[model samples]
Target: MWDKERRSVATVFATHGAASGTFASRLPWLSDHLQLSAGKLGIALLMTSIGAITTMPFAGRAVARFGTGTVARTLICVNVAVLVAAAWMPSLLTLAACTIVMGAVAGTSDMAMNAQGILVEKRLGRSIMSGLHGTWSTGVLVAAMAGSLAAHQHIDARVHFAIAAAVLAVAVTWGTRSFRTTAADVGLAAEKKEDVPLFVIPRGVILLIGLVGFCGIYAEVASQDWSSVYMHRVLHGDEAEAAFTTGMFAFTMAAGRLSGDAVVGRLGAATTVRACGVLGALGGILVIAARSPLPAVAGFMLIGIGVSVVVPLAFAAAGHAGPNPTMGVAGVATIAYGAGMAAPGIIGGVADLTSLRVAFCAVAVLAGMVALGGGLLGRNAPAALHGAEPVRVAEAEVLATEG
Candidate 1:
């Protein structure tokens, strides 16, 4: 029932969403094939994070210079191509280089596609942000499952990713047709120099929204990487049993997002996000206290549902937050992605020093902050932001950090 624009943007979201999980899901095979030690493999994997952190901050300018569809489509091709080739990497160093390239492409594509999602959300005039994000979560689950199947069947990683690449190519060709440029994009590229800002530091409520997203981003990525480890090492779960932890989180996260729009309509984004914070906090605490794999899985389910819609809604707010939607989204995405990339290292370091339980407790504190600071998201959100002549940034976030 979605129109062309909405469907096109949704495809972009799906592709972007699948990139991280697909690559990540293949890690075991890749490491074994390359004979990479744990430490070496970790360093190699860092290439993607480095690429993302380095390139994402600059994506706003590219999105402004080119239409979101143009940027997204171009990057999707690059992403798919890189992913396919990266799987064929014969040496450790080469794989690291391949991963770096994939990271750059995926990072830029993430920003562009999210920008497209904002455009579509504006066109719809309702809270469809959660649904769009749900699509991404679904893609992640699908690709992860596919990777697992391929691994189990002992299929070549090259064959698996090449097939994925071919499908994405088809998706890009069909899916990018209706992702047209928005008015905000035109204004950004137009003659009004005063309307454009030199740097996009989200102002007022937007900054708070970004902060809220920061908490979720950190928790989301860290949990994905560490949950299984905690179950295996901390709770003495077997291999298959520990793996179920990730599945539990993924399934519940997807379900939460699929139901998120209705929840947002009923309770509003502000309230929904606030509630997510409380739930995440409780889940983290539960995980810490859980002595068995089953209770730990249950706790992760709560954590998954709690953080599911937080980042999506935050991106929606940022897209419509400032005078320039692209830049606003860029600012928030940059902050959140950076936090997410660092979270694993921080949490792991804490686990090394103390234990996994202690590291998880820290996440609970951040979630509590999200609940405490929930008021900042919509303090001045006007009735409608989709077609507003000149959009305004969140005033509170900007002023609080003012020089």
Candidate 2:
């Protein structure tokens, strides 16, 4: 019984997830096709992060100028093209170039779609962000599975990407029709009056919120990338057991997100986030202290559920924290994405220096930070930002930073 606009925006989220997941699931093939050494491939892959971080600063401006629907729809389609181009690249250099464009388009579209989701949540006057994010996770899972199947069939990566591009392009174009701008969404455009900078570094409350999101994303990224390795290496689990541990984490994460709106509705965002932080911290502790595989598996599952809704709620908070919803979202996204990219390396470095248990202590500390900082998100928000209209950035805040 969802409305057209809400359904359409969800479609946008799903399609974007699918596009990114499709590329991700086929990366092994891509590396082999280009005959890249592991070291060279890592460098090529780093281009995606470089591209995303470099261009994210302008995403808010793009959305303001072009409208959320236009930017989201166009960039998602472009991302598909970039994926196809990447699949067909002749050499490591070409692949790196293609990945950079892939990341830029994908990151901008992500910010734009998030802005649109906030708009939809505003119009609906209830919690939907978590559900939208869950839909995105579902899209990623499904696309990844499909890519695995295609790879199993030995389908050429070139054909695989081209077909995926054609299908995803059509889906995104049709899905974004309702996301187009109208008079109602013009409030986001109103920020132009303040001479807002193209890229406003998050300050004060926004930065605090971003840091809260960072803690959550750090836990999430660390768990997603390292849980299986931890299982096999630290817990001495078999390969199947290690894979199962990863799957368990993914399942709980998706389940938690899908059910998070109801939880937020009942407990309120602030309380839910605080509880999530504590739970995540507890999970991190269990991981650090576990000497057996079962404890570690349970710990990862807890971490999954603990952090599932944190990012969605953070974005929701961001939309209301600043005069420009898009900018607020972009600022938060920039911080959160940086955390995602950094978590793996940081954890690995710590593990190299000491042990995986020691590396996970970092996750525990950050999760504890989330618990302490959780109050900042809700202190200024009214009614937990549920059904609240976007507010003007505080005059003091604007003067302190935007000036």
- Give each model's clash number: 8, 0
Alpha-carbon lDDT of model 2: 0.74
The per-residue C-alpha lDDT of model 1 at residue 272 equals: 76
For candidate 1, report its TM-score.
Answer: 0.82
Positional deviation of residue 175's Cα in model 2 after best superposition, in angstroms:
1.3
What is the alpha-carbon lDDT for the whole of candidate 1? 0.71
Best by TM-score: 1
Task: State in Å the error of residue 9, model 2.
Answer: 0.8
User: For residues 1-403, could you state the per-residue lDDT of candidate 2 as single tens digits?
Assistant: 1377788988888888778667756655665577654446555655766777788878887887888889988999999998888887898888889977876788788889998887666545567888888777666656666666776677887898899899989999998888745224523234452354687577877788888888888888677656756776688775446545655666677778888888777777787788888888888999989999988988888887888888888888887775567788888878876545456556666666677898889888888788787776665444534434434444564345323
Cα lDDT of model 1 by residue, 1-403, tens digit: 2365677777777777666556655665665678765445555656766777777777777776676778888887888888888778888788878877776777777777787776656545566667878877777667767766776677888898888888877877677787755544322323233444445555566666778888887778767666655776688765445445666776777888988877776766778778988998898889999987888888888888888988777787887775556676778876776556666557656776778899888778877777876665544333332223323434563344232
Q: What is the lDDT of residue 129 in candidate 1?
A: 69
TM-score per candidate: 0.82, 0.79
Off by over 4 Å in 1: 31-42, 88-95, 184-199, 202-204, 228-244, 351-358, 380-403
Q: What is the lDDT of residue 58 in candidate 1?
A: 75
Best by lDDT: 2
